[model samples]
Target chain A: MFEGGLDLSGAAVRVALPELQRLTNELLRASGLQVDHAAIVTDVFMRATYRGVSHHDIYELPGRLAALAAGKVNPNPNMTIINKYAALENYEGDNGLGELGGMFIMRRAEQLADEHGIGLCAIRNSNHILASTPYVETAAERGYIGYIVTRGAPTMGAPGRKEKVIGTSPMGYAVPTENDCHIMFDACLAYASNGVLAEKAEAGESVPAHWGLDSEGRPTGDPAAIAKGTRQPIGAHKGFGLTILGEIITGILADGQIIDEPQDGTGLVGMPSHTAICIKADGLLGARRFRRRTTELAERMEARASGLQLPGQRSARSRNEMIGAGAIELKEPLLARLNEWSAKLGVQPL
Target chain B: MFEGGLDLSGAAVRVALPELQRLTNELLRASGLQVDHAAIVTDVFMRATYRGVSHHDIYELPGRLAALAAGKVNPNPNMTIINKYAALENYEGDNGLGELGGMFIMRRAEQLADEHGIGLCAIRNSNHILASTPYVETAAERGYIGYIVTRGAPTMGAPGRKEKVIGTSPMGYAVPTENDCHIMFDACLAYASNGVLAEKAEAGESVPAHWGLDSEGRPTGDPAAIAKGTRQPIGAHKGFGLTILGEIITGILADGQIIDEPQDGTGLVGMPSHTAICIKADGLLGARRFRRRTTELAERMEARASGLQLPGQRSARSRNEMIGAGAIELKEPLLARLNEWSAKLGVQPL
Candidate 1:
């Protein structure tokens, strides 16, 4: 979110969020997506922007449109529930936009939870879901606990191994609190994502030592070497283990590709898969009690802070600070690019 | 298990595993447990030994017996299902041994998965469950993808705070493969467990600089300071986020204690709770195909590993190597203490 735009001195331009959202929706719709699907995908990207995580936001819009033009994504997908059970289901996405599929499956999972206390839905053949936090946060917003995992293209290597055999494999878990405040923990298993490393390399800056390895599998602080080689997991074997486990559940179990069979040319592997889980908080502990307890937990942790911060705390603060301002900061070049795309796609410019 | 025995000239003695198992069961039963419950507890501990993780093994047996003696643990518990849903259930453990409750819940979860393609069970008021790996592995062995989380005694601190607010909150996830092998990923969220840190401190060794903070929340390499202060999470805030999420689901959702409400020195906060999830892997991917794919993934990784090992690979190897050895290693002092306990409890010595 902090570092995804072209260099333009040290100043960031403020742009109205509504205008940006409208531009995103218009561009996607003009780029061959249905209006509803465009809205869904646009919302996901925009949510990242509002949360100051533009790294996963509309920054990827151009690439997504390129994928759509290349026929890698089906805008009008006839998604179907291929298998169903009391609390679990598997969906075939027909290679639709990942955000649409993710939203579709998450909503279904919540519905299943409403009927059965807990629900799980696995989706395959969905293009890259930009981020998982929003999907899980959606469940938390609906007063239920949510969990989601999406297998990305393989770029991470196994610990001590030269072979790249896993995706960043991001996962998210969220628990709801009162006032719509939820604790959402979303992270990729990799210590650093390829995008971040590439950005560092472009800036000619050194990365953290644990970020990745060189071609020889030796840890390096050189960003260029890391970008060319492979990203490492956060906790060595532990994170590697989690990444593989995620691939098994979200990819293999969904009848999607694993790292062994890499998809060529496509920025994303063939319609990467995802798993969404929803738990009825009220079903476990009465909703009121759970909310009160979460508030107490958060307050207690805040009081104990010696400098450490909770997840989403910074994002929430950033969102609150910008709400009244009516505009969000963006790299000038990115803003210009969005306008160019709007002109090229015959959509109204921001 | 690797090393939990008392010092014995830097070497351990091999004792017949059956003999150790018999001794453990005898002591637990003599201390007040029913024979079946004792066997369940002994099996969980012995499994850790077979996997070369003696750190969480029978070394805890004496203390468990002490808890029973002190009436801190209920030897004869009336465990019951307090709440039930289509694919979920809450069990009241009535202060029973955690292993017994874990096994019960895992089996129930598997059954639920059989009926609903997925199942989840939460248990409350159970004594310590040695490791979640064995419990989730139990599900994998039954041909289901599994997950388990157990809240331990609070000893971990969140980011920025000097107060210990969360337990290591160990969690495990496993997927079954062919050849009856499972990829089991079990880990505590902390950078290092207290046991490991204490071991390092005892050996007059410095731990990793980032392992934990001193009482004042300043980073330290002295394991003693870390043990006395607060332990840091692995991957910093990412691990902290996970530990908090685990507590929410496994602890708070089960009506158990959280960091904010630190229970008094009862060794464990009131009957620590756990959550177990089992997914019917065959429900998503056909049984044969899923098994074959898992086998292929493991084989591919093994072939490419340049010293990087897959999770559970070493454990499986250790287990196979010891199966026919007819004995297992233990620190001489620990073995002697166990013998003394056997005699003190009027049970036959190993």
Candidate 2:
């Protein structure tokens, strides 16, 4: 048993991945999500943390739970397939939890790709999904290439001008390689994500000048300034183009019209909607041949660019280290908050 | 004619879009591309110029023709569908002219999406395609959302470190909107495209500090130095990630595999293979309702962001002015070269 390097002598022991997933699912179910929905959400949340993305970890769960309890988010959403044709489907998420809705649609895409050479799914009326990588990574693990994008609340920069008109839209892509090394790339089109801004705020430090704007839409580094202003696009116009594309793909392309207001009638909260696509490699080339070629290509790329690292390499290494160390280091305050939430939920203290 | 103030008389006489397309098609056909292939290539070329994308305009025709004469690209390729599923297809382009092959596959995707809700097509063994936006814009014009991505010849910046490892992969997305305004966004992940670098080199101008690196992988503003180094990715690591994702989506995901070696036979020439997708709004929502809602949503977004311009608005405006002016401006040397080429082909001088 790996002790998580925490003071667990008088508290309940930390659980393994599977155990944590189960407990998380139970908690979500108790809060009103269906069993399958809860499981999917739990899987995404746990995997994000397990993969070393602490910013997307369960630290935000209490706030989300509170939102759910207050009916700010739908608990028993009527997510249903609104349209389907051979390798394509469209799902109406009915303002459901985005993690669950996103996973379900991606899985459907995978299944369709398995039967056909390719599959695509677009979903509307969904809430925020913690991380975007897992959806594409899931398809990559199944020997398929995956693409996904989502539009969140308007938190990023506008186009040529400097005001906030779009969200920090996130996009993800994953492809299978040889030896279980799947190359995954995921990112938001903003110069800085809200998480980074939040961290800067907590640290009482200023952000990079290029990260955002000050009041009146001029560039600034003060975190407080960002609250009143907006984040900048990564490469000025280029990142703005990407954000627009993301919104079109997830918002308009998915047949989920890019509305200025939230689907829940709460005004423009910019709740995310998504588009997911899967392409089966085996369908294009025989499975063995595809695998071998992928391995060869990866090897050649690594050999040619001797110093460069492929996408996902760092995350994979971090995950391995966390596992080997049998512990994940967490900020003291965050851990305290987690324990407090656990106590309030009548769950065993971590 | 409007005779707009912008200088464009350096280019050949302006003709109607269709006439220009027809003339281009005739020229390409005379150079050896099949009739259908020539038509599609010409369509893209003409449309690019029509949209004020002079960087990817007909100015490239001479070089493309030279490449064809040198046997660097095939004009009469036996393009074939290598794999097919309900909503997806994999194409073997047989190392053909990329413009033709790319359009063929994207058209196939549009067809499938018309039947299904969405369709995806991946192609391998292709050459350069002038611009990606045309493919997606075509889909948008047909009432479908479109996505296209492709890997280019190696030219990428490293993360944190400054060096070349990948290509300035480009991605494009388009959606149909009301008021004949199709939102289109296309961009390369690099801070500066090679075209811009070449322009700076020609003008003997210093590039922006953030544009690229020096020969020894150090930051520099000298275009010559950057040519010896590599272009920077936008937003550092995040842009690097997007470039990686684009490579996988078009290369490995499409079964072409990432080409790593700088001197590898496969990496020496033009753009690599690509992936294209089309999602039919009518398939996702009923035709009438989908159209109505999309129009409403677009209006709403425009109303909410009252001061912001939508994607492609500036380009469209520029195109209108250029068209009304009856001529397209061109650099003196470029015009001289085009005349030279026209003379060699026994065509009347502009």
Name the DockQ score for candidate 1.
Answer: 0.59
Query: What's the TM-score of chain B for every model shown?
Result: 0.92, 0.85
DockQ of each: 0.59, 0.52
Deviating ranges (above 4 Å) for candidate 2: A1-23, A201-208, A253-259, A264-268, A325-327, A331-336, B1-23, B200-207, B261-271, B287-307, B322-335
TM-score of chain B of 1: 0.92
Tens digits of lDDT, candidate 1, B1-350:
12334554546887897888888888988988887888888888887777876677777777677778888788899888877767888888888888889888898889988987888898988877887777877788888989888885657777645687677778888888888558888888887877788778889999866778999889888999988889877677777887888887777777766664655465444357898989888887788898988877777666655565787788888888788787888877777778888888999987
State each model's CA lDDT, in order.
0.78, 0.71
Query: Local error of candidate 2 at B343, Å?
Result: 3.5
